[model samples]
Structures are given as C-alpha cells and as structure tokens.
Target chain A: MSNYSLRHLQELEAESIFVIREVFAQFENPAILFSGGKDSIVLTHLAKKAFWPAKIPFPLVHIDTGHNFPETIDFRDKLVENLGARLVVGLVQDSIDQGKVAEETGLNASRNALQTTTLLDTIEANKFDAAMGGARRDEEKARAKERFFSHRDDFGQWDPKNQRPELWNIFNGKKNMGEHFRVFPISNWTEMDVWQYILAENIPLPSLYFAHEREVIERNGTLLAVSDYLNMRGDEVKMTKTVRYRTCGDMPITGAVESNASTLEDIIVEIAATRMTERGTRADDKRSETAMEDRKKQGYF
Target chain B: MTQSGYLDMELLRFTTAGSVDDGKSTLIGRLLYDSKSIFEDQLEAVKGSSQKKGLAHIDLSLLTDGLKDEREQGITIDVAYRYFATPRRKFIIADTPGHIQYTRNMVTGASTANLALILIDARKGVIEQTYRHSYIASLLQIPHIIVCVNKMDLVDYDQERFNEIVKTYEAFASKLDVQDIRFIPISALEGDNVVNRSTKTSWYEGSTLLHTLENIHIGSDYNHLDARFPIQTVIRPHRQEYHDFRGYAGRIDGGVFRPGEEIIVLPSGFKSKIKEIMVGEEKVSEAFPPMSVTMTLDDDIDVSRGDMLAKPNNQPDSTQDLELMMCWLNNRGLNPSSKYILRHTSNEMRTMVKEVIYKLNINSLSKDESDKNIGMNDIFRAKLRTTKAVLKDAYRKNRNTGSLILVDEATNETVAAGMIV
Candidate 1:
C-alpha cells in the first residue's frame, strides 16, 4: 500500500518532461521555439532536464522580430551557448527584405504579425516535423482549446473545428509529408505555476521580468518602453519609471507595468494579488478581441 | 503570498459533460468567476462581447466558446481546457460538449479525468444525456463521479426534486461499474451552492460544490502496487567529463521505485539493479507514479526507447494478440482488414483488427453483436493483432500502460482510441 503522490507542480513538470521526450522519440527533427521569455526559458529548462547527461537533442529556434529587448537577445545567446545547443534564428526583417512579408505602417506598428511568415519559412527550410512551444492554455482564450500535439495543415493553418481527438497521455504526432505539429509541453501550466516552478527550480530568466529603471511612455493607459524600435509620437512623452514586463514580446508593442517586484518571490506575490490578466497590458493582444487567435491561425507562435 | 507552500498543492483534473441547455458553460463560468479565478480583464472582454451580441446579461458561455465557428454556431465543438486554483488544490477542467454526436469528444476528455462531473437539469430529471454521460464515465473507468443537479432555482430549490433525481440516477448507476459517486444540488446561474452556501438549500446538509471538489480523496487514485516504467528515450551525454553515462528516461506509470531495487527490462528480459534515480538536477530517494525521472542501472544492460522496467516477480502480459474496447474518433469508418499503427505507451507497431465482436450502445448500455460496422463515435469491442509484442496491463488497473491509440497509416491521423481488456 504505497501512498506516493506528486504535488501539482511536480506532476506538471513530469508531464511536460514526458511530452518533451515523446517529441524527441517520435519526430525525426524537432526544435524548441525559444522566445527568451520566462515561459520559453522554463521550456528550454525542461528540455534540458528531459534529456539529462545529454545535450538537448533539438536546436532552439527563435523568431527574432528585430524589435526585441537587447537584454533578451543576450540572454538567449548565453543560455544556448552554455547548454552547447544549436540556435536557429528566424528573422522577420529578413522576411521583409526578401519581400515575403511587408512591415506594418504608422504608430503601434510592430513586426509581431510578420513573424508568422518567417516562422513557417524557417520550419519548411529546416524540415522540422515538430516545433515545441512554451504556450500555455491559461495565457489566452484561443490557447484554451489547443492540443498538446496540435496539428497543422500543409499550408501552416490551424483548423480548430476538425482537430484530431487527443486522449490520455497518448498524443498522435503522425503527420503527412508537408504537415507538421506545434507541440506545447506546458499547455496545462498557468502563469502562477510557471512562476512558482521557476522559483522552486531557481531557473534563470531574462532581466526584463524583474523591476528596473527604464525610459517609458504612457500611451492609452499602457506603459510602453522607450526603445530604438519605437517611433515615438509627439504626444507620448518619455519618462523614467520602475517597471517590469508581465509578458515579453516585441519591444514596441509589449507593455510593462509599474512594480517593485524585483525578485521571483515578489513577482509571484504581485501576480497573486493582481486582478488583471498577464496579457491585458500586451498592446498586441489589445488590438482586437481575437488577436491571439487570428495570429495563431496564421501560424504565429 | 509566500511561494514556499504553493508548490506543494495537489492537482485535481475533472471533466464536465453536458449540453448547452444544461448550463454546463454557465456552471464552469460560475466556478471560475466565484472562485476569483476569472481575471477582471477577461470578465470585461466577455462582457464586451456579450453586449455586442445584444445580450441582456453577461453570457458566460462566451468565455469558453473560443473558435470562430463555435462562436458563430453557438456551441462547444471540441474539448476546451480551463484552469483554476484554490489554496488547497489546482483544478483543470476538460469541458466536453454533450451533444450525442460529440460522444467521441466526451470520451477524449474523460480519458484523463480523475473525476467526472455530470450536470443534470432539475426541470428534466434523469434524461438520456445523463445516462449516456454516466455510462461513458463508467466505461472510461473514471474513479469519481459528481452528479451536479443544476438549476435547482427553477425547481424552486425543492429538496424532494433533487432527491428524486438522485434516486433515479443511483438506480441507473448501480448497473455501471462506478466506484465513487456523490450528488450536489445547485443553481449555477444563481451562484447557490456552487462556491458559497445558499440559504435556499438550508435543508440539504452537504458540502458545497467547491468544498466537494477541494476535499475529494484522490491520493489512492493511482495503481501503486505494480511497478511499471516505460522508457521513452535513452539519455546519453557522451561528454568526456561524464563518459559512459547511460540513463533511461521515462515517467513512472505505476508503483514506487527506489535506488538499489532489483528490476528487469521487459521484451529482452535483462536484469539490472537500480543505481540511482534523478529527477532533474537533484537525486531522489524514491520515484513513484507520474514522476518523470532518469534512472541508471548498475549493470550496463542494453535498453532503449519503447522498453519497460518492472519487478521480475510481477510482470505485465507480453503478447501480440489483444482484446480491446475502442472508440472510433475519425470521420472515416474502420477498415478492419487494413493495417493501422497501434501506439501503446512509447511503443508503436502495425496492427490489424482481427474481429469486431460487438458494439456497445452508450445510451442503452447494451451490446449489439451483429452490427460490426464501426463508424465515428462508435464504441466497440474488437480483437487486434500487432506485428510486434506489447507489454500491457488491463485498462481497469493502470490507464497509462493499458491504453493504445490506432492511427491510419495513409493519412497519419488517429482514428481510434483503445483500452486493453
């Protein structure tokens, strides 16, 4: 009569590790979609744990929007180099230069939407049958219905209505020649779970997650970080404030919130007491109600 | 606000099956809203969408109806996962649609659920949907079943009506193989007995829905008697510092494993002693069910992916012939004679259906032996022969090691989900 049971975080970690291993076993070529965000950082950590004593079997694929925080790029390169893992960069600017996708115009313009083209192109060029992402269902509405082994059509489109029924721990990643899968090992994790796991494991993350004094402008009730990518309008005045990002995205569109939560413990506490969703401050999601869903349908991670 | 104890909270995953009319979405919405799991921004978004659609009240269903087609059609087309947490436990709700045609979806959701939540309308007591869902829950071997008699307000919060419905369900459920069953009467829309106790239901002396969910005994849900670990992959660093490091990586499906325990690798029948168990960076004294860890054996035995490790005295059946109850998931009908990919645990092999013995009628709970044509959403018992032998247990014992899915080779789509008998 063994009475052994795993706690929620441990169980979630085990499940994710299991999924990560399954991806390696089932697919000939797979990669972790590294965005330098906390979620992706945790994912890369899990992948490393999944195949301990061994280098992560797959490369880390990052879709660089060219509008990222300099700290994020540095963190990405350092982590990849330390782990001795290959890093694949899918540049949205390259896609624009190649005339595959045009850059958006006017204020609030970002390379966020154009990453889909570059991402798909990278997947095709590399022939990656499975691309593991750090997307969690609790992060957005569209993600709530996502499968652990989410199937994609040859055209890189997601048909939500006709998804194959996934059951138990058995995920069917079998696909045709041109088709691929978008696998999310952390689909069951919530934002709080991710933070708690990070704190428990002492996983290193980009410095953007902690409070820092940075130049920012308040636009439409959101604190936009003043960076080289942003074309600051005359009305938007820049000022210095202590703020931290709840989510990491393009520097021009990703908004930060004023906070003193510098440590992981403080961030977890701040989130616990927060009434707003993490993506509420993200200007990209604020563009429309189904912004995430629309972007996901177009093959954006 | 402290982070120390939050990681120790247990996880409870439950599935809810009910049609749109039964207020399934509303019940889930209420659970999220009243528990403070629903963020203000999410609530505001739902409110804006509700107002756009000319709704007098905030339609909570809009919170879960995610897809454009589902929103336009006003129904849940697939299983949508929802997460919430209390101080005591974290919950994952696999919200499955309840229309009869979507029986496959319900089965998919119930497959991994620790508990099955079947909502019954107080106005229409013990309907076909209730029986169908209960039967499906029983068939899937979900350990616990909580029958929520919803809309008690419409029935004037009558205790007698709730009791009558419970009696009908109990009598019907007695025919099924359900282990633990509980009843809760509540009005999802009125927020009575869902999260908070209601004055209207003062006659009822039971825990609220939230209380029942938080306090369910789920410690003994897993099979800890038999030790089973199916290796998903082999971890080999090959670095000069840690040369000759060969660790088998997989999640423990059943029982408890400790360092120095004697175990045998399956299929090849190689005996080895457990040297160490590593869960991430730390070394653990013991590993149990659902814990993924890398284990190194004392002897340099040859072990690869799709292999199983178990106590020599207690071993699973290794055979090519299997008897299984399968739910057809795809739109295409079953081709019994054609070869299909049968994936069990981490092992995959080609399999062919030898015979379709019978089809189980979910609503009637009867077997139709004559009809062998299995179509979408059909549950049937069949004989399968795999090209390679598989290590498996009965589905009633261990779900992780006892289930397999059949995929069509041509299209590479999962066509059926099977449970070993």
Candidate 2:
C-alpha cells in the first residue's frame, strides 16, 4: 500500500483546488461568486491556496441583493481587502431602479429572485466567461444534477436536460460568443463536509453564522431576522433571541435557528446533530416544490 | 467528537446503474434514509409530493428525480448525484439511468467512480441491462463491482433465488475485467441487507451493502508506482517579495515525488531536479496522486501547462498515433474525414479519426467487425492521429493519464470519451 492516503477533508480540498485552478487555466476571464457564506468563503480560501505566493487570478463577484445583513457586507469587504483581490458588486437595487426587475410585494416579499438579473447583467457587462459558485450537490434536489462546469446559453439560461457529460477530471468549458459557464469547484461537498472543512481550515466566516442576540419574528414556523429590509406586520411581534443563520442570503428571506453554537467546533457539532437541512429554514425555498429548480433555470446561482 | 471523527473518515465515490423498474432510486433512497442522511424537511417534502399523487406509499423515486420533466414523466432522464456520510466513510453516488438508450450517461457517471453498483432484479435474474452495465463498468476500468440483487422480499427472501442470480451474474462477470466483485441480496424497499442486516437473510454470510462499502480496501486504488504530473498552469506571482519564485501548479496523477528527485519534463525532454513541493505555502516533503500542489524545479526548464513531469526512469508513452476505446456521447455520428479536438489531462489538440476498429456489442460481449458506423452510445476501438504527441498510459494501467475526450470543434460538445490502449 502507498503511504500517501489523505483524509477525506484533505482529498476534498485538493479536488476543489484542482477545479479552481482549471477554471483559471481554461477560461479567459473567471470570477468567484462570493456571498460571504461559509461555502464561498472556503472556495475563496481554496482559490488563494490554488495560486499561493500569487494572488487569486480571478476577482470576487458579489451579487448584492441590497437586503443583506450589514455584517455580511462588512465581512465581504474586509476579506477582499485582506486578500488584495478585486470585488465586483452587482446591485439588485440598481436592477430594480433601472426597471430591469420589479420588486416583490406583500408579506413575503424579497429581492432574492431579482439578484439573478443583476448577476446576468454583471456577467455580460464584465464579459466573464466563467462565474464560479460554491453550489454543492447536497444543497438542494435541483442542484444534485448540476455539472461542475455548468453551461449557460446566451441568455444565461441553464438547460439541465442537455448538459454535457463531465467525465473524470476533464471539464469542458467550451462555449460560443456571448455564452458563459458556471463552474462549481465544490459541487461534491455536503453541508457537513463544508462545516468540517471550515473547522479544519479555521476559515473565518461572517458573524451571522455564529450565535448572537438579534431581533427576530416567527413566520411560517421559521424565525426571520427583523432588519431594515423587512416591514413589521400587524400580527407578527418582534422578540430578542440568541440565534444563528444556517445559510446566509437576503435578510428578510434567510431564516435563523435558535442555537448556542458560537464557535466553529460548536457549529460543526450542531450541524451533525441536527436533523433539518441548512436550507430547511429558508422561506424562499418553501415557496414551491421546485422553487430552487425554477430559479436556477432562470440563472440564479 | 464529530470533528475528530470526520478527519479520519475516507471518501468513496460509487456509481449505480439500473433500469427504471429495477428500483435503483429506491435503493439509493433506502441507503440515504437508513444512514440518516435525509433531512426531515426533505422527507416531508417527499411525503407532500407523494400525497399529491394520491399514492398510498411514498414514491422513493420521487426524491431522486430532480428535474421537472423527469418528475412529470416519472423517470430519471439524466445523472443525479447523491451524497451521504457515515462515521467510517463519505459516499457519493452517481445514479445513472440503465436503459439501452442512456448508455452514454452511464459511462459518464462511471468515469470518476471507484466502484460500480450493478442493480439486478431478483425476479429477472441476469438480463441484457445487467450485461450492458457490467460491460461499461469494465470498459471504464472501475476498480470494484457490487452486484446488488434487489427485491428479494418479492421473491419470498429465498436464498435459492438469490444464489441463482448470483451464479448467473458471476458467469457473466467472468468475461469482464473487473478486479473485485461482490454479490449481495438486497431488498431496497424492505431494507434487507442494504443498511441493516436482515433476519430473513441469515443464511447469507456476507456483510451488508453499507458495511462492505465502508470497509472496502481502497488505499491501493491509485497508480502509485509510476509518477505522472501534468501541469495545469504555471503560478508566476509578479509580487515584489516573490519576484523570482516560479511554480508549476497541477494535481499529481500518479506515484510520488520528493525534493531532489531527478525528473524529466515531457515533450521537451528536459531534465530537472525538484527543489520543493508546496501545498498552499507549506512545504511538503513528498507529493502523490490526487494532491494538487506546486512544484519548483532546481532549474527552469521552460515548463508550462499541458507539459508533464515524471520520473526519469519511468515515463509514459509520448505517442501521436493513439489506439483507444471510444464511447460516442453525442447525437452526431463520428466522421472519419472530419477533425475533432482531443483533450487529455490539461492538453488539447486537434485530431482525426484514422480508423474504426470493430464496435463492441455490449449485450453479447462480441465485436461487430462489419458495422463500423459509430453513433451515440456505441463503443468502438479506433485509432486517432493527433497534431501533437500526448503522454499516455494504457487505460488499465493509470486511469488519470490514460483517459481522453474528443470534442466536436463546430459545436464544442464533448463527443466521445476515449480510454487509451
């Protein structure tokens, strides 16, 4: 037997780095989609490792929903500054203001879906041949069938049925003019894997991930953080709770779970012991059975 | 406890092949559910969908059929990946459809998998789909094969029926080139010999499917005897501190390399001694297969992407006339006169199909010498002449350096997957 066996996390890390390097080599212009989430944080860290002694070859693209937690934006800016990597923010507010996308109304309104338009427009404006995301197959049912180098048409639409067969480590990123690709470096990672990786790497994440005192309101059995983006409803009463977000997205739509897991080690334990998926608390996914699938078809990351 | 345990766990990626009626999705669903990998919300969603369909029992297949058209048609049209982990190992299942029409999808899924799970219905013993799947597994050179004889409960959990199916499969599998083959009688619906051992299967002495998957010896799955590193790209930081630092970055395909080892850069045939191997700022003494690292040479030998670094004594063949087993993946048929782009490792070059050897009949394990037309899902041996010489090994020797893909230049679609012979 060879004395070269790596731990599961190490193997996954190496695989992800290989994919990130491939994107750097294959595409003329590629950017890592940074949402300040744990997955994207790990991806950006991997990109740093992929070209160590050198800066990350690609810029970090953030499709700012404009409804994000202030802590997330602060963390995103700080990380970008620390790494000396460029940050490109595509604003959903700009898209709405420019009449490219209309804002949702009523109780469960969110700018989450509108970010796709800003994202596509940003890719077109920048002419990014590949936009790498931190999407994992274990995240959602619709994402399970996603390719590592997912292809997008000229309109940035995903055709799940006619996806190219990704064999071995050979990723085909070939596309015509005006078309682009969505490269997922960590497509094989599970939620548990991501947490375990964060713990192993000591990766810094946004403060929203850890337990904190925050004002929240319960809606549809989920605790929504009370922020400027959310309007107070008549029957919904706000309360203070020590909770942490399982996933980071728009403030109004992204839900938080009451937890005492403050440290990375504590968070890993909490995730391992939990029965609900990370996306289970997100109100946007509960809109329909194929909500994520529908959104991805329309170019949502 | 979870953190420490996760660090010791190994990862195993396996592919499953089964027809629509063979309960492939059910088997996967049972594995995930029994392992507690399925979240409560996911199960609740599946239950709601099942109620909407007015079905008495929850359709486990609905959990795997992800696409909208697939859900509407009640069949899996493409490959869907599923992940689950236990204390011992992490498992990634590449679930592919098993109809004769979707053989290309099966091949694609099996390409990266360490093991292939061939599902056979107990009622129908060994059928054509079984042969077809097994053949593809062998062609892809998957290291392990697990013949899962499912639906034993429908056959009254009869040991005799299971043994008969196992015997027929063994007879058929003997014709293939798979190294390790295990047979297990499972009832994916009743949860027999899948995750938990069944009392009804007490006569069987084998381990459960989950246990086998966890304990399988996969340490020697990679090619560690011959060192092969194809540079993905060069990392030249123009920073002031690292002005003179140049590193060739890529994942090691095979074997091990240590500092001061004499290595030869391929195609250029220039020799250099390794100065250091870096894995993200930390200097490692040695590097091996699948570990993406940066290597700095003692001498700058003009190495770039698509170039290889191997031990001076041990080297792969640098050849232009390549003979390989090709599985056509696109709807467009192979045109002998037209040129296609051949992508191997990090290298891409234009190539032409020189000759079409006999097409392999997957069902009968026979070669049809007369039918030279290679269409979608057709596996054939062919000679390809590339514009540039590529470093390669036989498909059976090293999978990473031995495999290549043909891309249709006009559409830029991956047309075929080739295994270098």
The TM-score of candidate 1's chain A against the true chain A comes to: 0.98
Q: Write the per-residue lDDT of candidate 2 for residues A70-106, one digit (tens) a residue.
A: 9999999999999999999998889999999999998
Model 1: clashing residue pairs?
A: none
- Residue-wise lDDT of candidate 1 within B273-318, one digit each (tens)? 9999998667888888898999999999899988999999999999
Q: Give DockQ: model 2.
A: 0.67
Which residue ranges in model 2 land beyond 4 Å of their true spot? B1-6
The CA-based lDDT of model 2 is what? Answer: 0.91
Give the Cα-based TM-score of candidate 1 against the true structure.
0.98
lDDT of 1 by residue, A9-78 (tens): 8889989999999999989999999999999999999998888878899999999999999999999999
Question: What lDDT does candidate 1 reach at residue B249?
Answer: 94
